[model samples]
Target: MKRRKFIGLLGGAAASWPLAARAQQTRMPAIGFLRSSSSAPSQFLATALREGLKEQGFVEGQNVQIEYRYAEDEKERLRNLATDLLARPLAVIVADTIAAIQIKAAATTVPLIFASGGDPVAAGLVTSLNRPGGNVTGVVFFATLLGAKRLELLRRAVPNAAMIGVLTSRTSPNVEAERGDIEAAALALGQQLTVVDVNGEDEFDTAFVTFIRSGARALLIGSGTLLTTNRARIIALAARHALPAVYPHREGALDGGMMSYGASVADAYRQAGIYAGRILKGEKAADLPVMRSSKFEFVLNLRTTKALGIDIPPTLLALTDEVIE
Candidate 1:
């Protein structure tokens, strides 16, 4: 009887070992997604992020978990959201726009991946592009630097416009840099530039009125998640004021803006996601080289141009990657 009992106990222990090991192996690591904009306009970007992680063998709710937090375009709310994400069991933090700054400040031990439209190095998110040399690394869209290019595109679309109005987000970290680049470009093109700094949706109407009163003939929208979140209103205001406008993303052109030229925002998010997955897979954030967006697309809306009574030049139209009828 004693011998039989000993053999039974040994078998039970052997069976439990594999069960415990399996449980430990299957434990899901949580990834936190922190964004400065609302989730409504970011759904497509979220899907792109998921696809990137899948490429790295991290499937949400399968081998990994995701914690999502959004600031809803309220800059004041970002810190709170970041703190909330930090409180969770996060193995890596995937952030975008201004949230990168907040996350970088809060979580030093946790790896951070960001999709920043601004200059990441200038914003102090990383040490350098080639060697990030810290806990933060991801894709930089160089959206602020593209201000000059976007201005040139607008000028081409409205060559006769003597003055152009720039709608800028005061809360954006890259606002000053973008404004400076746009100003330089405008001066080089021999055009007068009027800039209006706005922080919220409530200020759009007043800013548009001011631009119109200033005799600004065309509009140039700056790059920021907040501005993109409120894109429909900006496009509508431009149409109502009879202002030809250039935007920073293809979606803006699809939403009735006159023209757009910049890096693909969705692709940037996907790269960020890929970096997050790599970090979760035991790769150090400091080891990952910072990535720049490889895809840039120019888009034009023919219907918007027709409604504004402006004829798009064949040269500009030919340069567009996509045209919305």
Candidate 2:
């Protein structure tokens, strides 16, 4: 009887040992990265995001894990992607302003951090900028609000342009605001503006043809993931049309667009990453105030200018933060 009792006690202890050991192994937190752009263009943004996480004492694959879901510019896939990310036991979700909407609708408990080009307050993602007051808080670049400024630069680059073609993505929620701002700006500048709506990548060539037929001397590319993802083709179209154009972000100029003026997208992503790390470290999402993107840059590509036979204005070139010869 004593021997049997000892064996039973030893077996129970052995089973409990493995359970204790498994409990001791902490599961690492995961960050779900949801975007509407492709991975190829997102390399720099991803690196910047990682750098931000490093700043918060979190390293990918070490203390934290990042699950990336790129929709490759297909807006239709965003809701499904958000649902899939929600299925995972994610510690937090970091996304673009547009994607943030979908994620917000899918998960109510999981915290959301975003890097958006639109106004979060206007989009109803947050109650206010100073106090987000919800499970979502991150950075806003306000790229759509800079339409007038970009048009001004395009006008400066092509002084004689009376009519400018504005390419906008109709599917984006921010389109109406962008159009209103751009139209007001164009009227203020005394330049005729033709707004062309592009719904997908396939409509790009047709939009360019429409712009050409409308007799536009210059073009203003709108802000959105769809436009940014297909930047190379749009820039090519602009070059083929011999149209001097201005883009929203530096990536466009770096990718061979004529000129760009907007917030640094990579920096915004880095900020989002930093916020995500903080949230994972026990900081409440509502307590963290929304951050506005302040790092705007003006980039000019002289090579594209020369190729299109458009002379860069001395004043505009002087204002350029970066000039690609």
Candidate 3:
């Protein structure tokens, strides 16, 4: 009878062992994603990020979960929403710009991966780029002031323009700093930069009026995603006023703006996705140094140039990575 009891006990223990193993395997890691713009996910980056995660064995509904929060209309709410997600066991949090600001303050221990359009060190997100030193490290969209290069490209597209207009958001947090960069670049190029601040549809009229009044023959627009989203209206306004315009990113050019010169947004976001997957595979955020955009896209829309009565330089057309006719 003692031998029979011993065998029975062994069977029970074996069954219980699998239970403990299953318990350990069942606890899914979670990630929190904060999007400041409604169009963020619709872009190719979001999809690329998900694809990266899948490659790293992080099947969204299977091994890991992500809590998504979007402050679509009111970007001001990103921080508060991120704070709410802080109550959970988040393995990593992905944010950008103002959304990153809130995530940094909400968790002291959780890892953060950010892809912002500003200086990470200047923004107080990390100690340095090579060694982020803490729970933060990602990529920067504004690698440098490519503003003047953009202006030069616009001039090439519209060779007859003797004056160029600059449109920017007077209310952007980095407005003044960006203005200085653009001014310095324009000065170095011996090109005059006329500044026009637009904040709303009505303000656009006065802003364009001021641009023309300043004798700006072409428009070089600034600001970050805020300006990119309003590209349709800006493009229309530029066309209506018969002024050639240069935008910061290819998206705007694709949206009908005359030309764009800047880092490839699609590739940066793809890298973000790759980073996210690496983190899931036991790579620490601190170990992964931030990367600058090595690839810059020069996009020119032949259709837009024709509509503006401008002739795109053969040199500029030859340098373009993609020309939309």
| Candidate achieving the largest TM-score | 2
Provide C-alpha RMSD values for all models, in order. 3.1, 2.6, 4.7
Full candidate order by TM-score, most accurate first? 2, 1, 3
Stretches of candidate 2 exceeding 4 Å from the true structure: 1-16, 19-24
Q: Report the candidate with higher lDDT, 1 versus 2.
A: 1
Among these predicted structures, which one has the highest lDDT? 1
lDDT string, candidate 3, 1-325, tens digits? 9999999999999989999999888988888877665565335556656776776767788888878777653546765688788888888887666577778876788888887666777778889989988888888777236776776777677666667888887535466667778788778877876887665445888888898888888898885545655667788889888887888778878888888888866566667767877887788988999877877888888898887677766777899998999
lDDT of each: 0.89, 0.88, 0.75
Clashing pairs in 1: none
TM-scores for candidates 1 onward, in order: 0.92, 0.93, 0.84
Winner of 1 and 3 under TM-score: 1
**In model 3, which regions exceed 4 Å deviation?**
1-24, 39-42, 73-75, 170-173, 198-206
